[model samples]
Target: MEDDVRDDALDLLAEVLVWRLAGDRWRAVERALDGLAAAGGDTDAFREVLHDLELAGPARAVRIEDVAVLPVPEPVRERINQLVHTLEGPGRAEDDPE
Candidate 1:
């Protein structure tokens, strides 16, 4: 049950980030998602990120500038950051040995 809630929140956060991230941040974010997938860390979250990345490009193809400037509410950004930290897991840096 706890895992489900985490996964769901991670999914929503990933989706929001894919669309809301400013400038070229999405590239690094995509790379992070790829790295997470390669490391087999949270398959569900990886899939969610991929799904949102797929939609994000075309969804903002025309109004890219407008969407780039669209403000993400402060609360949502904070929650997303919290979910990202949870996804990273405690005492588990990217270089840490499993």
Candidate 2:
């Protein structure tokens, strides 16, 4: 039940980010989405991001003059940050064997 709520919230956030984001932020969002996918984030949203990337063709780094400034609510902002942190996970050494 709790996990469902989390997934739902992340899905909603992903939906919002997908439609509202533009410019350089799109690249960051794409990376974050990729990390989220690796971190076991929502499948539906992840699939959508993958589809979007496919439609967008090869990923290229670019910067344009116009950039959208998304005004996220505090709670939503915090939640998104938390999700990214979860995606980041523990700070472990690359060569460290568990």
**Each model's TM-score, in the order given?**
0.34, 0.32
The lDDT per prediction is 0.51, 0.46
Tell me the tens digit of each residue's lDDT in model 1 across 1-98.
14664466466556665465554544544454454445345566656655554444424344545455444446445545754674658543353432
Off by over 4 Å in 1: 1-46, 57-60, 63-69, 91-98
Which stretches in model 2 have alpha-carbon errors above 4 Å?
A: 1-5, 41-64, 67-98
Clashes found in each candidate (C-alpha, N, C closer than 3 A) = 0, 0
- What lDDT, from 0 to 1, does candidate 1 have? 0.51
User: Can you write out model 2's per-residue Cα lDDT over 1-98, one digit (the tens) per residue?
Assistant: 14554455456555543343444454555465454445354566655554454343223543454444444335445445565455334442232332
